[model samples]
Target: MALLETRDLTKEFGGLRALDRVNIAVERGELVSLIGPNGSGKSTLINTITGMLEPTAGDITYAGTDLVGMKPFEIAQLGVGRSFQTASIFPELTVSENVEVAAFAAEHDSFSVNFFRRRDAYDEVRERTDHILETIELDAKAEETAEALPYGDKRRLEVAIGLATGPDLMFMDEPTAGMSPGETEMTVSLIRELLEDWGMTIFLVEHDMDVIFDVSDRIFTLHEGQVIARGPPEEIRDDPAVREAYLGGEEA
Candidate 1:
């Protein structure tokens, strides 16, 4: 079975249908990219799948469980994690502390103050936090405040926070947005490494065609809140609808 599957999923904002009976399936260990023009519902699909927005109709099946009505925390607990277009991290906290906060939330049974009464009692959470920092190559800056890191590192720290949730599947919304060419390249490399070395599945939404084509196992092109096409990168690049609508008929 597909690792994640959606069947005729629909989400409406008043009379506007943000998602129109969208159906998608992601296999385990696949790096799938979502692309489209603005307002094409790429982010809407991600938000709906991740429980940030409730679907108006249809089924979301992940690992054989229906996810349509689940809460955001419930989805995270089911081994799904998400990183936003804007980096989300604690600016005042040290890099390590940022990841530690996510780790504590993911590992603990409750959010009560009593959970923090004994730091030593949560050795596993601490170890996982450190491991996530190392995995994302932020160990050297573990003690630095999040706001002090460069922009690229700040983005990476957001990924680390997502990693702290121990997800098998991760949704990254425009991870390379507003980055320099060099920074974008490095982030692309890091994403490839995450898939290859960390054995995680990724569903990515990115405007950078180079990064998406270079890294995606398959690409889904959306138009007006529905998938217009889905295929390998080569096929997608040549698809008439995709080329005309989003790629602007430019040769890749």
Candidate 2:
């Protein structure tokens, strides 16, 4: 079975349909990219699958378990993790503390009294946080406040936070947005490491054509809330429908 599957999934905001009978499947260990122009329902798909927005119809399954009706935290506990298009981090908290909090949530499922304990109290959480920080190359700035870091580092910190959740499948929503060329390169490398070195499956929503073409094992193109094309990178690059819908008949 695929690691994540959605069938006839639909989401409606009143009369406006953001997603329409969308169906997609992600296999284990595959880096799949979802691409399209703005308002193509890319983020809506991610949000619905991750349980931030309940689906209006159809079914969602992760690891063969029904995901519909589950809360976001419940889904995360089932080994699904995500990073937002915008950096989601605690600006006032130190970098290490941000990851540690995610790790702690993964372990305990709820922020109870255990959250008040000393940071070092949980050996496993501390170890996992340290490992993620090192993996994302943020260990050197572990003690710095999250808001004090550069924009690139802030984005990396979001990735580290997601990693601390110990996910088998991760949803990365434009992890490289608003980054300089050098920063984009660094984030791309980190993504490669997550898939190749850590052996994790990723479902990515990205706009950087270069990054999508370079990293994706398969690409799905959406337009007007429906998938218009899906194929390997080379095929997606040359797909006529994709060019019309995503690039306005211009070459991709």
Candidate 3:
């Protein structure tokens, strides 16, 4: 069975539909990309799948079970982790501390309430945090405040925090947004390492064609709130329909 699947999922804002009859299936250990122009409902679909936005129609399934009516954290507790387009790290906290918070969540402990309890027992969280930092190549900035780190590093910290959730499926809204050429290349490499070496399944939405083509095992294109085409990189590249929607002229 597919690890994550959505069937005819939709969310409507008044009469305007954000998503309409979208069906997507992500296999375990696959890096799938959702690609489309702005207002194509990529973010809206992500929010609906994560339960942050209520769907007006349809259902989502993870691990062969229905995900309808589940709360956001409830979905997380069920092993779905996600990062938003905006960096979601704690600006005031150090990078290590930011990941530690997510580690506590994975272990089902309260970082907020247990902030001061068992200070000596935090070696595990610290170690795990360090591992994630190293994997993302942010170990040198572990002590730096999240707000002080570079934008790309901040996004890496966001990914680290998402990893700390210990999820079977992760959704990254845009892993390469606002990055320099070098940083974008580095971020793509990091994603490949994380999925190929560390064994995390990722469903990420991105506008960067390079990142999408480099990372995605499968690509799904959205237009007017529906999936218009989906296939491997080669097929998608050759698909005239996809090109029409993505690169074709709409101007008169």
Which candidate should be chosen as best, given TM-score against the real structure?
2
Q: State the C-alpha lDDT per candidate.
A: 0.88, 0.90, 0.85
Off by over 4 Å in 3: 85-87, 109-121, 248-252
Note the clash tally of each candidate: 0, 0, 0
How well is each residue in 1-252 modelled by candidate 1, as lDDT tens digits?
Answer: 999999999999999998999989999999999999988899999999999999999999999999988898899999999874334687999999998888888767444566668767478777888887777788999999999999988998888888988899999999998889988887898888889988999999999998998999999998878888999999999999997776563333
Give me the candidate number with maximum lDDT.
2
Checking candidate 2 for backbone clashes, the offending pairs are none
Clashes of 2: 0
**Candidate 2 residue 252 C-alpha distance from true site, Å:** 10
Q: What is residue 236's positional error in candidate 3, in angstroms? A: 0.7
TM-scores for all predictions: 0.92, 0.93, 0.91
Model 3 weakest lDDT span, ten residues long: 107-116
TM-score of 1: 0.92
Error of 2 at 69 (Å): 0.5
Among residues 3 or more apart in sequence or in different chains, the pairs in candidate 3 whose N, CA or C atoms overlap within 3 Å are none
Candidate 2 has what TM-score?
0.93
